[model samples]
Target: MRLRTLLRSSSAVVLAPLLAGLVVLLLRADGTLHPVPGYGLSVLTAAHSALPYIAAACAGSAAWEGGRLKQGRVFEQAPARGRLGIALPVLAPVWLMGLGGYAVALVMAAVAADGTAPDLSRPPIPAVAALLLLAATLTGYLAGLVLPRLAAGPVALVGAFWVMAFPASWQTPWPRHLVGNPITGCCGVGQAVAPDTLWAAGIFTAAACAAALLTAHRATVGTAVTAVAVLALGTTLAAGFGQRMGYDGTVPRAAAELACDASARPRVCLWPETPGRTAVVAQIRTETGRLGAAGVPVPAALTQDPAGGPDTGVLGRTGELSPEEVTRTTAAALLPAPLGCEQPAREPLLGWLTAVATGEPPSDARVRAVLEQPRAAQSEWFRAGRDSLTDCGRSGVR
Candidate 1:
């Protein structure tokens, strides 16, 4: 078949509308356009959002091509060209359509990010999506060869959709992690997708593609045994790695070199990408000063870095550095770290401290009454509550 003729008859016509719908969905959801802050984040978001549609299209198209070959009795007459050689020309357009859609999605994401340079430290999400698409195509082709011509395309399409979409809703977190879908709750400036997650998805999808290709080429008993062994090993290794990941599929990003405001007491440091660095630093300093004046201890240095030391205070990596947000975060930072056990008074203490630091009335009646005490007595009560937080062995507000 000529390349032009194959393309003219292929499922690219169907895929165009699907890709357009995806674009429209994204645009409607986001509303206004602003450049995404990081390169890795843009790639991750684009590839994940495009995967289901592209995978479904690829699978359906491949299934149709496979059915066409079966109907024409091409396999029975095969002595002129190798099976792979014959299949390659027929499947090439389907592969091109899927990859072309993915490439367009990536380009759109880059444009949204104002063409930011790639962040090398992040996992290769775009490559993972490509591999998964190949797996979908092979699996679909295999299904078509086995099933009736009329039923093959629709069945493959639904099966592909289910494989990509249903795992996300499963109660078992590990299965979702291995499906090559983007991890849930991934990626703020302070966090990245766990490497284990990428490894699992990569291994499982690659193994699936290999097995599907081998089985499609030759359905011999030996080939079946080899395919089963490959799949079993891949599943075992993928599950081993995936089970270690949390439901959220993210981990604290390694600390990067930060821009610091050195002159302030208790120096303030922020990621270089942070907007309005001077205002953010000043707000942090002002809030920490309020905590100190209220007789609450503060960390010697405050940082926005995820990997900051135990003694160092941490600020939020997302959102605007508004005064209220700064005061709440600064006040919370002064609290004792979790002792791996419950501290009964911790909530009340945090509420009281945040109220005091923000110069707002305490919400709890008990906290309000404590605040009405004489200055010396109030200080004593505050000190006692603060101490109780670090000592899980201790109890009570007084």
Candidate 2:
């Protein structure tokens, strides 16, 4: 009897949303810009993540309405071994049903960042988090049946909503990486807090979920482990790594391998490489001028990989910067920040970068020599003075 109740209730709850969510997924995955059904598709795509748990709650409700399945009426009266085995297995499908929507959200989030997702074929954290949250919410819904229908359903809905909303501000490292986050803004999935390694967070979240279920089973209903609840709290209190919440920041993957030594100044590493080289090198000279002006020497290589770069107080190689980036960097190097964009925005720094990135010659090659050399005051560029390279104008400069 309990078996019939479980089967019927679970099927009804999961199948309905599964159908709806599938439609949403299909329409979204289908060719671009269709209509009508396309409208439903878009709406669901937006809120589809929270739908699965709602379905699960409805399943719980269906079981309750079955009368004999409610509370311990029929299931508890059955043999404990068979009952436990059957009950445990029932949880698996709903968790899985939660997956489709989870995948959609995760993928979309990644695409939103970088305008493309890396081929990160690792296990999905958000899906697993969704399953865990769904399972816990089911427990709450089932146990709270004494509440009115309006109250009961709303609990699951609100829960799904909250789970979707909160994790972003708290961007904890491992824990946040383990779960699907709803608060990520338009910023893409891993854009804000990508994990250094998926294995750590994935394994732990799985273990935590298992422990939650096992504890609930062993201790009886009212004594259920507060594992999920506690985990949520922990998520709230967690801090980001270094400064990025444990993520290595938004450094592009291509930023690796950019380097420069004291003898050889680093410049942009590019595709068909040299196209960006002239502009970048010139910008570096301009950028170094800022430090020199302030009496601090700057390096020829303004390369900086926000995630991994030389500790030499230089920007380090952020791989190759485009002509545009060269211009920007040159400007950044020349002027001190808290830049006043208020006026037409003419600053030495801005002019420097603009000149370099735009393929114009820098103001002076002599300045370049001085700036690139370790000794700020002694380099040929500085000593030869600022006017030596009238030809530096078209070379690159702001």
Candidate 3:
């Protein structure tokens, strides 16, 4: 009976955040996601942006568990002190243990689930864990209100973990917005989704909380009610947030236009416009090194005529020092008539090892290594540019 009660207790814990994650996925799935060049910008950017919400999702689970206590369906039972007795031996231990497991499970699922848009890689494990804890703290208070001293907590937690394992719908109303909230999920879409999604999600969350608060004050909380309310909250959060974060339209027309004019492959054109061609050339160099070899396939013009054409890798690695050797080599190839480094369309002038070794000094490398990067543009190239400066007498490699 104890085990059964505990199992039942965990329901809300897992359900809320998982639903929230699902909501984000659903919302963002329909939007535009340009492949930000081979610098891997789009993918990397998506990854970093996604972590905060994942943390929130983890928290949603914890919150769901706590809601039982706060709302007095279970955890708050016993003769005051008796509640502590129940908690130390059974509730608190289980709470911590289960939370760890559920958090790891959810994060692993997210990391493995998608690679295309939501970018599952950016969030560090620790940060996600912290967020999960925060969510749990809020949730625990609610769990206190409606659960039976012996039954509420375990049921909410176990159930919460379960919800995280599958795709679910989610929504929320105010007051208790903390439980079914979807605002965090909106972070996943980047700038792709509509701003209204925020208000929409917030309104729903406010309503849910209000109902939960009223139910608590009226002493109407129960196991069945716990299950229904939490499940509903989780599902709505997942579905609603999914809509907000999921991308919908075409890559901004500008993304396509840039790609076409790039004189490089479609990917080269895909990068956000802020980084200029020279910086792009630097990024190409870096990717080519990662991909290995110099003659990889690219756009046509770059191959046929040099001088920053889109064909065959870009001129220099984005983060590598401005290697005079590479720059000289590329400058010569693209304009052999003037600079004299061309070896024909089929062959590239530089090699992987050579490119890696190229960056020269004004100590550009030092600067790139230390500069702060913008949220979306935090790539090797951006870091490098922050470090780069032209200086006379010195080789231009820095």
Give the alpha carbon lDDT tens digit for every residue of 95-155 in model 3.
3543454344333334433433333353422233333343443344356444554564465
Residue 176 of model 1, lDDT score: 79
Ranking by lDDT: 1, 2, 3
Task: Mark the 10 consecutive residues where model 2 has the least summed lDDT.
Answer: 33-42
TM-score of each: 0.85, 0.51, 0.30
Best-matching candidate per lDDT:
1
Candidate with better TM-score, 1 vs 2:
1
Least lDDT summed over 10 consecutive residues: which range in candidate 1? 27-36
lDDT of 2: 0.40
Query: Clashing residue pairs in candidate 1, if any?
Result: none
Residue-wise C-alpha lDDT for candidate 1, range 234-317, written one tens digit per residue: 988988888998566777766664677889788887766566668878877776787777777788888877566866887754
